[model samples]
Structures are given as structure tokens and as C-alpha cells.
Target: MLKANLALLFIILPFTWMISGQFLFSNGDKILVIITVIALITTLFKYGFTPFKKNIINNQYIYLLIILSCISVIYNYFHKSDIINIRSVLCVILYFIFIPLNIISTRVITYSTLIGSIGAISFAFWQKNILHLDRAVWQLNAIPYAACCLILMTAAIILCIIYKDKKEILTISILSAVISFYAIILTETRGVLIAVFSIFLCLFVYVFTTKISVKIKITFITILITIGALGIYTTQNRLIHDTVQGFSQYKQGDDLSNTASRLAMWKAALLLIPQQPISGFGDNFEPAIENLYHENKISSQLYNLHLLHFHNQFIDTTVKHGIIGLVLLLLFVFFPFYILKKTEYSKENKFAIFLLTFGIIISGLTDVPLEHKQVFTLYIVFIYLFLKKTHSVK
Candidate 1:
């Protein structure tokens, strides 16, 4: 009973804090920092720092890579001017806290996480519609939250197909998917839409091509067709309008316009690349990028908005951390896919892992999912758990 409760708390706390942090806390809130500290303490107490254990260590290369990354972070913190970015610091610390806690796996964690995610999605929908909050339209502050939830829901669906579980679990998975998709639609985030669509397309193709039973295949095909039709009707008119508006704004070439501002920001980020090509400017690159925009008189209106990071994740990482950072980031992003490929698991498990890994990689391309503490914490915890599970099977 104690173990079950602890497992439930482990899953609930991280996910709950992640979803609620955006709605309840302001940027750089001490509450978030305090929560991180508490999580770190709990993880240490529960997991007991058994880093030398073979299962926890996993691979020597991973240990070296993580150690080096931590070293880089420490070096940046002490030497770099913008090391005081408390949010970034806390995000890194959370990753450290989560990795060990995830060393021990439990079905309680999985079920609790799924339940919590559903509740969060419901809350997000309520916030958007009943409360009529504009910010809630994006659901969470970051598009990646929606993306992560969608990935998990997709995994749950695959589990339902594979396992001979309770009918209620399967129903819950379907409901979670529906809720996640609804939230994603309201975000109006093109990147997330594209990623979700890509995953659906892949799943459709896989189901159609595979040797699954005719009845199952037909059901999947029917669902796919319905989803596709709905997606097209919903996105066509509004997406076209938004694309045209953005393009027109770009053609007008006004620095203050949204389209032109992003272009200018991209240019400013590029300009910083040559100065610190190897490691860029670390966390301070944002202010420097803004200054470059100001100096060029590219987009004073946008620059004056106190924009801290580039809206684009790839550009942001390249400018801030340089090539080394990019490599480490790539490894973190791609490692899951590599592990999935190695797993000789059941088709359902493989499909689920593939979709989850692909969704994360595609989402990371456009948004800095790793920079947000809530998203980062959830992501690291998931990766750690999934990797541990795979290794245990091996």
C-alpha cells in the first residue's frame, strides 16, 4: 500500500505541477522553484543515490555524456553573465532529480500519469471555454505540453490494443486522445498541428500495411478517415486565412509586423553564430540577439517586448550553446528513437514508442520544449522511465 501510494504520488506530482504551473504561477515564480527543491529532496530520499548500480548506470557512455553536460552547465553558470536565469537553472536541476527516481518502475505510475493527464486536459478545456480565458486558448503556456499529452495518449491506445486489460482503461485512453486533440486544436499552433498530423499519418500507414486482423484494420481505417476529414474541414479555411495574412504581412516588409519580426529575430540569431560559433553566447544570447535587432533597426517594436529567447528552438540552441550544445541536444532527442528501434517488443508497444518519440522530436524542432521547466521535467522523467523499461527487457 505504501509503495502504491508513493508510486501514485510520483506520477501525479510531476504532471500536476507541470500542467498547473502555467495557469497558477507567474514567470520565475518562487513557488515553482520551491516545488523543484521539494521534488529533488523527495527523489533523493526515495531513490537513495545508488548511482553505481548497473541498472541505474545503464551505459558508460550515457554516464559520461550526462556528466559532461552537467559540467558544461556548471561552467556556464559560474562564468557566463546570464547564468542567473533561475528558470533554466531549475530546469536542469529537475532533470537531475528525475533521472534517479525513474530508475524504479511501477504500473501505478503509468496509470496515475494517464489519469492526471486526463484531468489536466479537462481543466484546460474548461479554462478555455467556460472561463473564456484567452491565455487558456493555448491550453498550456507551451505547445509541447499538448504534444506530450498527445504522445502519452497515443501510447495508451497502443497498450489497449496489445494488452488484455479492463475495458475502462481502453475507454479512458480513447477519451484522453479525444481531449488531447481538442486542446491541440484550440492552441492554433501550426507546429503542433503538423506534428500530430504526421503521427496520425504514420499510424494509419502502419495499420493499413501490416498483417493485422481484417476487423482491427477496418476499424483503424475508418477512424483514420473520419479524423482526416474532420482535420481538413476544421483547418482549411482558418489555416489558409492565417497563412495568407502572415505572407501578406511579410511582403509588406514592416519591421513591426509579426511576420517581419520573426524574420528579423531569425536574422539577428544568425548574426550571433559567427561571433561564438563553437559555443555561442550561452544563456545570454537572447539579450545579445535583441541588441542586434535594435542596432539593425529591424524590429524595434518586437525587440522592445523584452523577448528573452528566440521563438524558434533550433535557432535558440544554436546561438546560445553552440555546436557542442547542439550535439548533446540531438543525442537527447534522438536517443529514444534509437532505443525504440532496438526493442523487439510487441507490435503495439513498438508503435506506441515510435509515435511518442517521433512526436517529441518533431515538436522540439519548432519550440524550446527543453527550456520550460514543466515540459523539461516531464520529458526527462518519461525518457528515464522508458529507457529503464527497455533496458530491463533487454
Candidate 2:
């Protein structure tokens, strides 16, 4: 029962941000994280710490990543004003990497998908129908809100097709997928669409290339293609021409253009990276990049738009944490793909994690999905859950 509760809370981590956005004074992630920590402690006592100790050598890359991140944070601690924030980040690194993936089961993964789907779908419905908003963003900025929508949507699909849960849960899973699709459309985030499509493309390729049943491959491809077509039709602005036009305007140096603004920030980050290419300037990175924008005499529109980080994860990590930081973060993100390829494992785990990690990387190309509370939290949890070695744990 204790384990079950822990699993439920793990799935609801994404919804915490949803709640925080809705309430006037509430810090949803903080409250949920505290509850999760308490639950984790209770399970640790009941099950013993052995769950986290298994297969340490197999996950040497993950530990190496944790060490590098800690070292970088410590380097910045003496000079950065946000000393507490730096420490908090180090703690998070430890917490995520050390989670006992032994506790994860098929049931837990499906439950997380169902619950997150329900939570995000409800919020999206409320924002669109009752609020009468053209773009349904609830309490989150459009980017994070849209990121949550797609993540939950993908989770719902994985719950159904990958886990192959009971018929009752299968019904719920299908419903969740439908609702997630609707929410993704209403949110109108281009990155969300890209992430979702990338998921389908990745899955389709997997199903086709693997020795899976022909029926499964055909059925899955048909469903995904149909859904993708419908989604593209429903969201008119999420069109190829629209994106091309944005790029064209950006190329023309349109300061107000979204693509142009993102480019400006990326350029600014690249310019400053050479100055501090080792240990970064650290927390509250706005002033450093902003200063460069002034020196370069570029338009200040991105700063005005409250664009905080470089939208690209690789670029942003390199800027704030330097080349060493960038290497660690990349290994942390991509090591699963490397390790899983060389070893035998459950196809479900491989596909689930691949779908997730791939979507994140693709989305990161155009936006800062890592900065969003929902995206990073989900990534950390799923990474540990799917990658852990199979060992019996009580």
C-alpha cells in the first residue's frame, strides 16, 4: 500500500505545476515535492535501501553526471548570489539519480499516465470552455502549459499500447489520449505539435522495424497517422506555411517575430559563452546575456518578452554552466540510448523512455522544455524508472 501511494504521487508530479498555476498563492510543485519526499522516506524504511543500491556499476554514467553537476554548482556557489538555489539544484540531482527504480511496475507507469492525463485534460477543458479563451493556457505561460499537454498526451498513449494494461484501464487510457489530443490542439503550441509528431514517427519506425506482429504495426500506424492528420487540421495556425513565414520574417530582422526573438537570445548566449567557457556565471543569467545584447546592439525585444534562458538546452547549459556542464547534461540525457542499445531489455521500457527522451530533445531544439517544471520533472522520473536493472525487491 505504501509503495502504491508513492507511485501515485510520482505520476502527479506534473499536475503540481497545473495546480500551482491555478491557485493565487499556492506553490504546487513545492507542496507536491514535499509530500513525495515524505512518501519516499516511508518506503525507504519499509523496503530498506537495497532497492537503490542494485546495479550501481551499470549506471556509472548517471553517477558521473551527478558528480559533474555538483562540482559545477559548488564552483558557482562562492560567486553566485543564489547560493541556496544552487544547493537545491544539487540536491535534486541526487534525489532523481538515486531513486529506487526497483519500485516501478507496469501498474505504476499506467497509473501515472492516466492520472496526469486526467489532470491536464480537465484543466485544458476548463480554460477553453468556461473561460472562453481562444488559447487555453490555464495558469501556465503558453510554453509550459503546452509542454504539459503533449507530455501527458504521450504518456496516455504509452500507458495503453506499451503497458497493455487491463481492459478497464485500456478504456481509460483511450479516453485520456483523446482528451490529451484535444488539449494539445487548443493549447496551440508549435513545439507541442512537434513533440507529439516526433513521438508517433519514432513509434511507427519502432513498430515497423521490430519483429512485432504485423497487425500491431498496421493498427498503430493507422491510428497515429489519423490522429496526426486530425490534429493538423484542427489547429490551422500550426501549419508548415506559418512556420516558414515566421522564419522568413525572422530572417528579415523582424524584432517582434517569435523565431527572430529566439534567434536573438541564442546569438546573445553564443557571444557570451566565449567569455566564461569553463565555469559559468550561474544563476540569474539574464544580466550576462542582456549585457551582450546591448554590446552587440541587437534588438532588446527578446528581453522585453521575458525570455530568460537560451531556448536550446545545449546552448543554454553551455552558457550558464560552460562546456563541462554541457557535456554532463548531454550524457545525462542521451546515455540511456547508448546503454540500452548494447544490452537486452524489455521492449516496453525501451520504447517508453525513447519516446519521452526523443520528444524532449526534439522540443529542446526550438524551446526551453528543460526549464519547464513539468518537462524536467517528468524526464527525471521516467529516466530512472525505465533504466533501472531488473532485480527482485520487496
Candidate 3:
């Protein structure tokens, strides 16, 4: 019992920050490493090596992908070009760290998420209202900031419903949900807006069908639709205008707009995949884009910038590590959902997994999520915590 309490105490800040600290660059990574070390020590002292064996076996797909990724690194090393992808390697390390983490109670997880939502929205407000920034960017891109806010908002809203019997937690979750929604609006990211509306519709239908009075349900849906419509109305300047403008520019033979650039990169990635179907380009992905430019296969507008990745996660993984890598990435993302289905976990656990899987899939359509360390850590750690069979007890 002492060991369990100690583990929870050590993880509270780091786990909370995982949800809120997408704006942090390297500092978040450092804190994660430190807490992971503490988790490792405490878990070992409490349960020895036996506990590690089962979770590791349960998460075989994740470990398999990590192994293959490391092999790719070694393969690139011998080839003497595109020798390493530090981001991928760092993600692998994060996965390893999460395995030893002791399972935190559901209540702790709920409160931590509440704290995280407040922190995330506070930062967004500071950036937009106080600093007067065009987009709420601080040490991270606005796109990712919006994505993280979406996660916080979704989690908080769901927690509010799950813990509605508890007045204090319910109140905190509601505040987090509201602030988190505002934070997403402040980001001016179109991709996350699509995700937000999608999730909102899904959650609304979920609540509407629940065992509640018809009038209450009607009132709930009315309030939710009002909020959703208002959010969309507020962001029309960026969401609707930019999308229409980008499509119009593309049709007019101009590929300079943000959406057009993403389209071009996706095209280039598809074309490149067939050329290196098995072994990918490793870290020379950008140079391959340049080659396509010189050959007139892609636009010079895309080639001019030092673009770090293809905006889409699947295409980016396919380009970087080929078909095999893409397969592994899919397995890694969907494995938790699969586990939830095959097991009789609690409803809260299942819902957490569903929200995460849905959010990642939706957001990945517009961004490379794992390339960002904070986002990567957030996904892996939560997946482990919520899905761990033995450690979920309060």
C-alpha cells in the first residue's frame, strides 16, 4: 500500500503535465525521464521483475515496433546516409519508460486531467489575450497546441459524465471542458476543429441514448448543439476561409497555400512509397522531396521550405520507413483498442481508450503526432495506464 501511494505521488505532476505540457519543448521530455526513473525504481521494489514480464508480453506489438525501428537505425548506419531519426528513437525510449509505470487510480487520473486542462487553457489564454499573439503558440506550434487541447477537452468532458455522482470532480471537469474548448478556438487550427466537431457529434449521440429522461436529454442536446454551432461560427475566418482559399488556389494552378502544400506533400509521399516499398528513405525524407521537385514531380513551393514531415502521419511513416513501418505504426496505435475489446475492462477504461484512439486517428490525418515528443509520451503513457489489467484498482 505504501509503495502504491508513493508511485501515485511521484507520477501526479508528470502525468498531469503530459496532458498540459504540449507547449513545452525539451523541458517536458526531461521531467518525463526523471519521473520514469522514479516509477521504475518504485515498481521494482514493490513487485520485482515478475510484474514487468506480463505487461511487456501484453504489449508485444509496441515492443516489436520498437525493435524493428532500432534495426532500421542500425541498417541506416551501415548505409552511411539518413543514419538516424532521433525523434523516432526518442519515442521508442518513451515507450520503454511507460512499461514500468505503476498504475494510478481512476480518481487520480481524473483529477490530474482536470488540472492539466486548466493549465493548458491558461497557457492558451496567456498567449492569445495577454501576449496578443496571432496564434496561441509558445515553444510549440499552434497546430499541436490545438490537438493537445482537444485531448484535454474530450477527456474532461467524458470524465464529467463518468464521475457525475461526485460533485467536486464533476464541477472541475466541467470547468476544464469549457476552458479547453476555448483554448482550442484560440489555436486557429482548422484540422483540430474538424476533430472537435466529429467528437462532439459522437459524444452527443452517446449521451442522448443514455438512460435519462427525454426532457433532460433534449435540454442536453440543445445546449451541446448551441456550443458546437457557436464554436464553428467563431472560427469561420480560419476554418472555412482558409480551406476554400487553398482549394481555389490549387484549382487555379497555384500550390502556395497551406492546404495546397499538404496536398503536394501527400502526393510526393505516395509517389515515393512505390520506389522504396520495403526499406523507405530513413531520415533522408526531405532530400527525396527535393529530388521530386527537381524532377518536376512536386511543386517548388513545397521544396523551398525545410518541411520536417509530411503533415499526415500515415504518409509520413510510409515515406520514412516503408510499408513495414506503416504496418507497425498502425498496430501500435490500434493495439490498445483491440485489447479493450478482447477484455472486460471497466467502462471508464474502455471509454478512455476509445477517445484516445479516435482522437489520434482524426488528428493524424493532418499531422505527424509521434514526431512530437510530448504528444508521443501522452499517447503511450495513457494507453499503458488505462489498459493495464492488474494495476487499475484504487
Candidate 4:
């Protein structure tokens, strides 16, 4: 029981801290990082870390990629004297390396996924009522939150389909899906909505083609019903208002405030890209964006905000780290999907890959979720575990 509890803590700590870091009034990631280190030490001393030795040594390419990315960051650090921002970059490396090294197994991954899903859903609820922070009717950073929930929901759904004796677990997964859908609506992030719809459509097609049990089919419908009901209850008013506003903006051919601002940021980023095209401006891209916005006389509220990132991970990488950085970023995003294709695994394992792919794609479109130390650490652990499990089965 103690070992199980410690293992669970190691799996979920990174994700819990990542979400909390954004919503909590305090610096949640700082506390999470400290806790993670302590947890790592405890688990290592308790479990002896030898279980992961073969997995780590076998998948050396991932290690190499991590090393290369770190080297690029070091190159940038020296070329541009930006020390504070380097913490974000370093956080990515630490999570990528430590998570895979410490916790990558089927049992650990499954436990982590379950716990992480709960933590993410809980944070969504806290953000809505507890935070009470308001902005535009349709503008919210709920995309990352929703995307995270959707990944977990998809995983749960797949597990229910694959596992027979786990009826109670299936019921819990259904409830989780319902709550996740509720949070997704609150986020008002159109990008995430699109991604979720697309993935579900694909899943629907897959399910239709595959030979699934009638019980599983009924369970799927019940899950959808729960999600739909929860979505209505949670966002009935905002949903109507947002829908009308969205349609009106589309009909009028006018960009919504948030969309317009993103366009402006994209343009500003493009302009700066040429200035220092190779290894562009390093981590000083935020200040560069501010200057560009001011020079262009853009009066958007987003322009006034001290933007830390380009709001798009790919563009941000190109602007900060150049082509090499962009390639590394693509590898980190794509390699897992390739591995998923190559490996013969259970439905739950495939679902994990789909979840990771969906999250990373959505995350790339808006805000650098991967840049956050806590979240990236969680991502790394998930990826490592997925690959290791697949390899073992093969």
C-alpha cells in the first residue's frame, strides 16, 4: 500500500502542480517542483530505480534528443544574456529526463492517468467558481484545461472498452467524461473544441468499424449523455451567448477580439522573425513583441499585455531557437505517434498515444503548455511510460 501510494504520488504530482500553477493565487509550480524532487527521492530509495534501467538504456534516442534540445538552450543562454527566462527552458529538460528515468511503466502510467484526470477536472471546477476571474464572454484559457481533461476522458473511455471485469471503473470513467465535457465548455477555447470534436468523430468511426460489445456501446452512449447533460447545466447561459456572439462575428466577417489579437501577434512575430531569423532573438522575444506592437500602433488589449510567448508553440520555437529548435520540437511531438503506430498494444495503450498527440497538437496551437516545468514533466513521464510499455509487450 505504501509503495502504491508513493507510485501514485509520483505519477500525478507533476500534472497537479502544472494545472494548479496556473489557477492558484500562489506559485503552484514552485511548490510542486519541490514536492516532485522529494517524491522522486523517496520512490528511488524505496523502489531502487533498477526497474527503469533497461527501459532508459534501450530508448537512447529520446535521451539524445533531450540532450540536443538542452544544448540548444545553453547556446541561446550564452548568446543572449537572459537568465530568468532560461528557467522555463530548463524546466522542460528536467521533466523530459527525470520523468522517463523515474516512472515509466504500465501500472504507473495507468495510475497516473487516472489520478491526473481527477486533478485536472478538479482544477477546472476551482477555476470557474473559486477563481471567479472574468474576461470576454468567449475568451478563456480553458483550452489547455479542457484539452487535458479530454485526453483523460479518451483514455478512460478506451479502458472501459478494453477491460471487461472493470465495471465500477468504467462507471467512474463515464462520470469523469461528463465532468471533463463540462469544463471544456467553460474554457470557451475554440481550438480545443475543434480538436475534441475531430478526435471524437475519429473515435466514432473507429468504434463503428470495430467489433465492440453491445454493453460497451451502451456505456459509450450513456457517457455521451452524461457529458451533454453536464455541459448544459454548467454553461447554458454562456453557451447561448457565446454561440450567438460567435455566429454574429462570423456572419459579419469581423474577427472576434481574441482572434484579432492572435492575428496581430502572429504578424508581429513574423516581422521579428526576419530581424534575427537564425536563433531569432533568443528568449527576449517577449520584449521584442512588445516593441513591435508599440511600433505598429496596434491598440488591441493583447498588445498591451506583457506577452511571454507567441501564443503558438511552433512559432515561438522558431522565433526563439531557430530551425534547429523547431525540428527538435517537431520530433518531441511526432515521435510518440510514430512509436504508437509501430507498437502492438492494448486499446488503453493506443488511447494514451491518441491523448498525448491530441494534447500536444492543441497545446502547440495556443500557449506553450510544454514550456511549463510541471506540465512538461508530466508529459515526459507519460510518453516514456507509453513507449516503455509498448516495447516490453513487443
RMSD of model 2 against the true structure: 4.6
lDDT of 3 by residue, 1-394 (tens): 9856776566455555556553345566666656656655655665677755655665654564567567657766754333224453454354344434444555666677777777777777788889887773364677876777777787777667667777777777888888889888888788888888888887787777678789867877887899999999999988999999998888776778888888877887898899888868776777677788889997777788677788998888888777877887787778776777787887766777787678878888989766666666566656666665533324
Better of 3 and 4 by lDDT: 3
Model 4 residue 333 CA deviation in Å: 0.3
Best by TM-score: 3
What is the TM-score of candidate 3? Answer: 0.84
Error of 2 at 146 (Å): 2.6
TM-score of each: 0.76, 0.80, 0.84, 0.73
Any runs in candidate 1 off by more than 4 Å, and if so which? 1-54, 57-65, 78-110, 136-144, 161-168, 235-238, 255-260, 294-297, 338-350, 388-394
lDDT of 1 by residue, 104-205 (tens): 334434454566456556656677778877752444573655655655555555545544245655566566566667666655556667677888888788
Order of models, best TM-score first = 3, 2, 1, 4
User: Candidate 2 residues 1-394, lDDT tens each?
Assistant: 9867766465334334322222111254565456556555654665556645663556654565466556656766665622122332333444443455534455555555566666666676777778877663356566666676666666667667654536755777777777767777777777778788778788778778888688877887898889888888877676566677778877887757656677777777777789889866666677765675677656666657665677787888777777867776687678887878887878877776777787788778878776655455555555655665442322
- The 0-to-1 C-alpha lDDT of every candidate, in the order given, reads 0.59, 0.64, 0.71, 0.57
lDDT of candidate 3 at residue 212, scale 0 to 100: 75
Top lDDT model? 3
Clashing pairs in 1: none
Shift of residue 359 alpha carbon in model 2, Å? 0.4
Candidate 4 residue-wise lDDT at 277: 74
Off by over 4 Å in 2: 1-26, 48-65, 79-103, 134-138, 165-170, 284-296, 389-394
